[model samples]
Target: MSHFTKCELKMTNLTALKRALEDMELDYTEAQANQSVQVRGWRGQTLDASMCINMGKYDIGVVSAGDGTYDLTADWWGVETTKGISEAEFKDRLSQRYAYHNVLQACEGKGYTVEEERNEEDGSIQLVVRKWVSD
Candidate 1:
């Protein structure tokens, strides 16, 4: 009996998500059949996921809950593979990269140029963008 935990994300951008994952050098596969993953659970806990990220012995899944959002799902017991990565850490890194790419894309779309970019000591990214307005 295994249980998959679900962490709901703020938005759904499969393309951006994939790019973010690649930027982090994580191995993943994009779902094309629009199918969902079914898994068992402890105490009747179940999960239906839309996408999956290969993590060797285990996998992290993303479930689309409609309304422009998604949820990250994975079994807690199988989270750590030979790589010794945790589910929370994986989600955190993914979310960070996702946010980075999301902001980057938004800035580029609004005619803004990235002036400075750096990783802070707090494990967060700092970006400086600028857009000049002609009068």
Candidate 2:
């Protein structure tokens, strides 16, 4: 049996989330407010999802689990997309972009400027920011 797992996000900014998706070059659809999606689970069970990302043969769903939290709903059993990316890979990529977007915003809010940005060969990102400290 399969069911939607709660991811528990601290923040719920659809705009930021979409921006992360765009940064990752992943195609997604912004569903109408309160719209629900049907996600296929491991056991071929259908679950409710609120967001959909086009992953060729199989798509992943970002579902709202309430309290400003979202869940990644999908079938882990025998799931294969054209990209041949696993669920963990997809989530990691998305989280990285998401963190990047949030960190940039946070640093700017704290009067910090981005000094350098580097993309690691291992698909990781490195960002350096500087802020003027009053003496």
Candidate 3:
């Protein structure tokens, strides 16, 4: 029997996202972040998946786990917001919006039930997406 694993969709900004990807040394390129691309795990991995950036905000960015997912951001044209928005508030709002849209679209595509759980204190959201696969 094969066990199924769940993937977590953590929301962040573009600069941070880039930094994290670079730090992990994940093989990727800057293609609008929202553009669809097939993501194959490195080093003989079996998980072949696709992803795109669903949103980006200031130094933060959000991505969809699909090829045509939106690479949307709250940043002002690839630049951080200068509208006198605090760093903490900026990150929180951007992350929440990204989470909302990301899960909404993902679940809609899957045609499955989705339950949203929000963390107001941290300004984050999670979607309990129902996915079933048989081995």
Give the number of the best model, judged by lDDT: 1
Writing each residue's lDDT as its tens digit, candidate 2 over 39-93 gives 5555456666777776655567787757787766665333443567776776777
* Residue runs of model 1 more than 4 Å from their true location after superposition: 33-48
Full-model lDDT for every candidate? 0.74, 0.70, 0.41
Please give, for residues 44-118, the per-residue lDDT of candidate 3 as tens digits: 222222232222222322344345342433233323333455435544554555445555665767876775555
Clashing pairs in 2: none
Clashes of each: 0, 0, 18
Arranged by lDDT with the best first, the candidates are 1, 2, 3
Lowest-sum lDDT 10-residue window in model 1: 38-47
Model 2 ranges off by over 4 Å: 1-11, 37-46, 78-81, 121-123, 132-135
Which residue pairs of candidate 1 clash? Answer: none
Candidate with better lDDT, 1 vs 3: 1
TM-scores for all candidates: the values are: 0.79, 0.71, 0.30
Q: What does candidate 1's lDDT look like per residue over 1-135, in tens digits?
A: 456777655557887898898998877765558666643334545566666776656667777877778777777567664458776777788889998999988899999999999999999999999999999
RMSD of 2: 3.6
lDDT of residue 50 for candidate 3: 29
TM-score winner: 1
